[model samples]
Target: MSNLDIFVGETSGTAMLILLGGGVVAGVVLKRSKAFGAGWVAISLGWGFAVMVGAYLSAPKSAASLNPAVTLGLAIQGGIKWSDVPLYIGSEILGAMIGAFLVWVAYLGQFSAFLTDPQVLAQQPAEEGLVDQKSAPNAGPVLGVFSTGPEVRNYWQNLLTEIIATFVLVIAILTQGLNQNGDGLGPIGILITSFVVVAIGLSLGGPTGYAINPARDLGPRIVHALLPLRNKGGSDWSYAWVPVLGPLAGAALAGGFYQLAFA
Candidate 1:
């Protein structure tokens, strides 16, 4: 693929990934939505379908690397050129931001109602200064719709959880999810990868929401911070680095393991 193909494919695919993935969380959590309170099963299945759709759409153009962690792992495994890494990652981030913005647009009324609800506002910290300090620093009320956060406040534990979950994801991709040419996912591989995501969410998502992709978490978090939503609370900037670094570290580990054990 040329640089343009890589840019367009990764951007569009990652956008689709976040659009449907985040949309599910919004639908389940946001007030007045038909799917409200649908629970975790819906979220897991939604994300799986999101991955399948995004990968299938972008596979022909840029091998459908919708996550920065996936791109990094593939680069380390020598399936992608080093020179193209930046384009892949940058496009994924851009796409994720676009997807997040679209989610906000799609759920505008729900977001407005949820944030402006008197009871919901009553739970917020009285002082704006306490938004990040005394209030939830790990996540805002609706922030989970945009990014991952830990249920517990321990930084090390959260980081470790992200690393372990991401390791499982990237290792599975490196070992069994790639196509024969080693540049993209085959149909079977895409199905396997989507199910792997669902399994990870089902088993490992409780602690930290399983942010196995840096762009998936960081890009949306940026959008959440910038969006003009009332009573949105803090963006949980303090916990942001954990998801970013942990996933990259996990991808590095997976790439090295693949080189040592499976290559």
Candidate 2:
């Protein structure tokens, strides 16, 4: 258990750093290219790419859940139509599972390579992981917390993080895309989301691991329990509800807020 603790703890911080690093690239790269629209599409695609790159680099293991509350918020906003949301959500889960599978496979490779190398595992020092590392800042007020990771593993903590993350994400998208300053650039909205994610991860992702994306959390979590790998053990089914419920709850709140603010 101590070995696993050191092992997992060592790499935990890597997740958020890569997440934000990818976001920075997304912001810088997407804006300059025409592959995606300039404003909201840019940002959505920016986030999507951020998710993809984070997933890619973190391959053989599930990358962090990119944006949990936003997925629920989009579902709530009807952005993912009623008829399509189920499929969207399912696809999201599948995508997340696949990403995790790859990342874990990669992780397992390193694990396999080191299974006999006690020295390697033992030498991995503390205070060297992403959990404590400094990352890019999210400008949005509510979003800055996302970059910090979640507070606790509790359902409510996850839920509140989701609420705030979603609220900020939506607000960022709205505030930027709808404005003269941001609307001109399509990805601005998504850039806004990316930073919001960074914010939440940096400030709020302590417990429950700031599962900002339901698919990112549950999908890979399910994978962790299912994959036939060495020393794989029980998955935390008890806390599964946090990532799932928190985002949805937050999205609902965002909807109310969105309605009142813009409607």
Candidate 3:
């Protein structure tokens, strides 16, 4: 594929991934939504279907690398050129941001209601004039609709969980999902990979919300920080690096492992 095709496909696919994936979270977390409190199973299934749909839509154009970690893994596996890595990662992040913005737009009323609700605001920490990270280090209520956070706030444990979960995800893709020429996933590969995502979510998502994709976490988190929703507390910037770095580290390890054991 040409450079333009790769950019367009990655951007569009990643957008679709976040749109549906984030949309599901919004539906579950936000009040007034029909799927509110639908629980974790719905989220896992929604994200899996989102991945499948995004991959299927973009497969023919640019191999459907919607995740930056996946693109990095492919690059390390020599399935993609180093020079083109920036294009793929950039597009993925941009697409993720766009998708998150769309999620906000789609749920504007719900967000307004949730954030402006007296009960929800009562649960938030008081401003106390100026607040530091320590004062409100945890994510705000609405943040979960856009990004991941830990049920337990141990950084080391969270980081390790993300790393291990992402390692499983990336290694699975490297080993089983790549097509004959090792460029991208085939149709069956895409479906199986989506199931792998669902499996990871069901088995390991509780700790750190299973943010195995840097773009999926970081881009939306950025959007969460920037949006104008009332009573939306901190974006948990202190913990942001864990998701971004952990997934990249896992993908790197997975790629290295693939080179050593499978290549």
Candidate 4:
């Protein structure tokens, strides 16, 4: 595929991935949405469907690699040329940001109401310094709609959780007998990939929301920082690197192992 095709495909696919995936979080977490408090099963399935839809739509043009971790893993395994990796990663990030922005727009009213609800404010701790100092403004609870956070707040453990979850993800992708493009699994493989995602969420998502993709987490986190929602809170920059680095590290490990074991 041409560079333009790659850019457009990745961007559109990743955008859709984040839109439906992040939209589920907003629907479940926001105060006024019909799906509010729908819980983690809903989130896991929603994200699985989101992956299926995005990959189906974007696979033709650029193989629909919506995750930078996927892109890097494929490159490391020689499924993709090194020269094309940057384009794929950039497009995924841009698409993720766009998808996140759309989620804010789609849930505008819910966010407004949630931010202003007295109970929400009342729930926030009176003291700020007690929390992660880097996340001073992140004391607000609603940020989880746009990004992942650790339930336990242990950096090493949180990082390991992301790594292990992502390692499972990338390894599955490599062994799935899907198309070689690394942008997507084919039709049947798409279904398999979605199921894999659901399994990861059901089995391993407890700790840090299973941020197995760098673009998926960072793009929305960047949007969370940029949008002007009232009481929206800090982007939790302190915890951001864990998701990004852990996924990448996991992907590298998967690629190296694939070379040694399967390639």
Candidate 5:
């Protein structure tokens, strides 16, 4: 599935959830950059598009969920606060979910309008499959002929992956956020983050689908349940806890590590 592929079939507009969920911080960081301002930060579309384009390169055939795992880790490490955590995450969830839904409806309309066009229908199966893989990022498509995806199967393994992946993501963020770029740290910080996400998605996205965030997985999972996906039964409650629990564990570990480094 190309970057645009999984954009289809959003029963609850989950695509917005995907974009804003991840872009919220990315945008703020950009605004704080020397070249940008709070106005630039408010340019939600710009940041979203920039990050999406960067991530899209790695995921021409995927949804690029990016996972809230990254956010949870940074928050715990003191890069963000507990009080503000809810809104950012809530925005992330709502934005991505909404975007997904809109993309789905848009594609559905296109498909219905161009029913005979094989290419239009060609992307359908992939996006449909993406809705299923929302809990885990970097997990391969569930639509391929040899697609053997684990449906919330292993708790510890999934949890472990979230921890490890978040570690990689958080460490990179710490380095970038603290580093002083030419003019300021903001631009490099974002570029650093986008790069970390891309690198993680490419290198370690194979196992447990790289959920990395409780909210990213669960919020979208909720959207999946609320939405009316075809033949989309079994919301996979068994593995829901993995993303939530694993990311928090990873974030706590990051906090410990950051404190150790600073102290």
Candidate 6:
């Protein structure tokens, strides 16, 4: 496909992917949503289906590399050209940001409640002056809806977790199938790739939320930091580099390993 086609496909696919993936998190976490507390199973399945939908939609164009890690891995593995990596990653990030904004619009009422919720307000020390719940120390409870966090706070461990998970993911993608046109995954390959995401989530998601994709986490996190949401917590910028760097490292390792072991 042409460069323009690649950009459009990745953008649209990633936007939809984040929209559905982040939507599920919002539904489960936000107070007023019907899916509130629906739990981890719902999240994993939702994200899997999100991948399925996004990959299917973009399969005809840029092969639906909705994650920057995937793009990096593909480039390293020679499945994608290095020259095109920037385009794909840029499109994916933009799409994720747009998707996150759409989620805010879709859950506008819930987000309003997130800011003004009695539970959050009750915690404010009356002497502190009207607590800017919107910009509260941790930004309240909306951070998870936008990005990944660790159950454990070990930076090295968290980085390793992401690297391992993304290694598995990138390896799976590299070995999945050869795209005849050399642009993206085949249709069946896309379906398999979605399942691989689900498997990774089910097995390894507990530690650090399995941020196997850089764009998926960073893009939404950036939106989280910028959006006008009420009581949205800190975007956890301190830990953000783990997800981004770990995945890139993992992709590089996977690509190198593939070239050595299988190529």
What are the RMSD figures for all models against the true structure? 3.4, 13.9, 3.9, 3.3, 13.1, 4.6
- After superposing all C-alphas onto the true structure, candidate 1 shows an RMSD in angstroms of 3.4
lDDT comparison, 1 vs 2, better candidate: 1
Query: Candidate 5: which stretches are off by over 4 Å?
Result: 1-71, 109-152, 178-185
**Which stretch of 10 consecutive residues in model 3 shows the poorest summed lDDT?**
125-134
Better of 1 and 5 by TM-score: 1
Please give the lDDT score for candidate 4: 0.83
lDDT of 4 by residue, 1-263 (tens): 79999899999999999999999988887778999878889999999999999988888988666888888877877767889999999999999999999999999999899789888766653221112323345545666777787767888998888888988988888787557554446788878889999999889997788889999999988998899988766778878898899999999999899989999
lDDT tens digits, residue span 201-252, model 6: 8899888778788998899889989998765656778778988999999999
For model 4, the superposed segments whose C-alpha errors exceed 4 Å read: 125-137, 180-184
TM-score of each: 0.94, 0.58, 0.93, 0.93, 0.58, 0.92
The residue-by-residue lDDT of candidate 1 on 61-138, one tens digit each, is 897879888888899888889899999999999999999999999999999998888886666432111223343544
- Cα error, residue 6 of model 6, in Å, equals 1.2
Candidate 1 TM-score versus the reference: 0.94
Quality of model 5 by C-alpha lDDT = 0.46
RMSD of 6: 4.6
Q: In terms of lDDT, which candidate is stronger, 1 or 6?
A: 1
**Candidate whose TM-score is highest:** 1
Please list the C-alpha lDDT of all candidates, in the order they appear: 0.86, 0.43, 0.86, 0.83, 0.46, 0.83
Which residue runs does candidate 1 get wrong by more than 4 Å? 124-139
How well does candidate 2 score on lDDT at residue 175? Answer: 40
Cα miss at 26, model 1 (Å)? 0.1
